[model samples]
Target: MSETEQNGEVTAQLVDGSTPATPEALFEKLDALDIPHRTVEHPPLYTVEESRSLRGELPGGHTKNLFLRNKKGGMWLVTCLEDRAIDLKDLGERLGGYRLSFGRPERLMQYLGVIPGAVTPFSVLNDHQDAVQMVLDSALLNHDPLNFHPLDNARTTAISPKNLLKFLEAVGHYPQVISLD
Candidate 1:
């Protein structure tokens, strides 16, 4: 196994090249909840499509996540499949917001401790204030197993959809799951 793998940095523990992450802290939290997961590390990609193309034939339905905020700077989590086309305006309305836009990179780092490409539900671990409200695309919940960034951008982790819920529970955040359609 590679050094990164040995350190749990490669696979499921994938991290951002720019962020100095505490994998031990993350794993410790996961361990506390006994959440089952596996990781794969790689060079970082600028887009979710790029990440998907690079991660061919993975075991689960990989999701593209978006961290956004309204005019009020209220944080929101948007998880969806690669193929889905989201009308952000409609999404904003469905989310009960008058307006929505991409949140600032600074806020991303502040609340989630993640930069843009590194946004993942695992980032919730860093949001100690519970400042971010999660909104999971319902379609994603149907995926038996799901893939997501493990608090960083350079790696991806696959875990059961149910286990994803367990992980969220472990974080003490209950996501408001909704359907895009």
Candidate 2:
């Protein structure tokens, strides 16, 4: 790991450029962007129910991310409140695409640089091609602090709602926030 201070904030870079940012590196980027955040380490969580068991009293808008693709091959990363009910059929129409289905694990890895259990908005950083469209539920933005996996399922990070948008924009993803009700 290499650390550098730029514009008054410290950032960490991976020694190997070929690998995606580790949880620590992701925290460094958040710090460099001046995006306030808190991270908690835990055993890997693959589902919302599993995460809820470990999150305990952490207060924030916990999220469940879906890696999806349209029939035409367009991809999307949809992040929403963990309890929100998402109808893939309706979402496909709203997104103006053919029926959407869960993206394959290989495609998810190719686009987001994370495996099935680690889907996250933070993974946008690894999308050097900017090929994945980001869809955020408006309700998640309504929370003061939004929580997500930091490109890894073994931990969760919370950032202010506004700062979440800032981080996404910085990573070349302009999120589309809509009502997921």
Candidate 3:
């Protein structure tokens, strides 16, 4: 089946006139965890620079999320400041043992149930196998309210730093806060 025939239509139907499982379910989980957050919607654009441009429209700190994979196909989630210049190689080395690369779209969909241009920590909610591990840039964790996608490109979610830690804990993953610099 083509991408459009599969999730595209379903996602469009769910997102066009209504919110879908990706973001809605994530929010439900957040609510269950008693984690408070605000959602912001934007045009579907796939770059950190574009996402950063929406910062003026919001009152939250912006973050960039990377869905990466080790050479062994182990998935990793890296959430950091939107402005930081992150070299994947340097990051892989610092993170230790295994060259990092962009994860395959198939693996992304299979593991996180998220498509390209919509990677986020919220996607981790779909990772029932606990295959994806999370890493938070220390600088970003220091910020008060950080914004990220709620598993969709059309919306952004802002949550307190404490709430973020809480959400991660709720998702059953203990994120490692590291200094990206």
Top model number, TM-score: 2
lDDT (0 to 1) per candidate: 0.75, 0.85, 0.77
Backbone atom clashes (below 3 Å) for every candidate: 6, 0, 0
Considering only N, C-alpha and C atoms within 3 Å, which residue pairs clash in candidate 3?
none
Model 2: per-residue Cα lDDT over 42-136, one tens digit each:
89999999998988888978899999998788999999999988899999999984699999886776667787778999998887778899999
User: Best to worst by TM-score, what's the order?
Assistant: 2, 3, 1
> What RMSD, rounded to one decimal, does every model reach?
7.0, 7.0, 4.7
- Tens-place lDDT per residue, model 3, 1-181, is 1133455554332212222246887888898988888887779858887876654667656777788998677889888887878999899888886699888776777777777778887777777768889999999867777887888888888889888888888778889899987
Expressed as tens digits, the lDDT of each residue in 1-181 for candidate 1 is 1113446554222123233356557767777788777788878865877986788777768777788888776888788886778888998888885488888776777677766787888888776777888878888878867887777677887778888888887777898988886
Question: Which portions of model 1 miss their true places by more than 4 Å?
Answer: 1-21
Looking at model 2, residue 129 earns an lDDT score of 77
TM-score of each: 0.84, 0.88, 0.85
Query: Which 10 successive residues of model 3 have the least lDDT summed?
Result: 11-20
Candidate numbers sorted by lDDT from highest down: 2, 3, 1
- Any runs in candidate 2 off by more than 4 Å, and if so which? 1-18
The model with the greater lDDT, 1 or 3, is: 3
| Candidate 3 Cα lDDT to native | 0.77
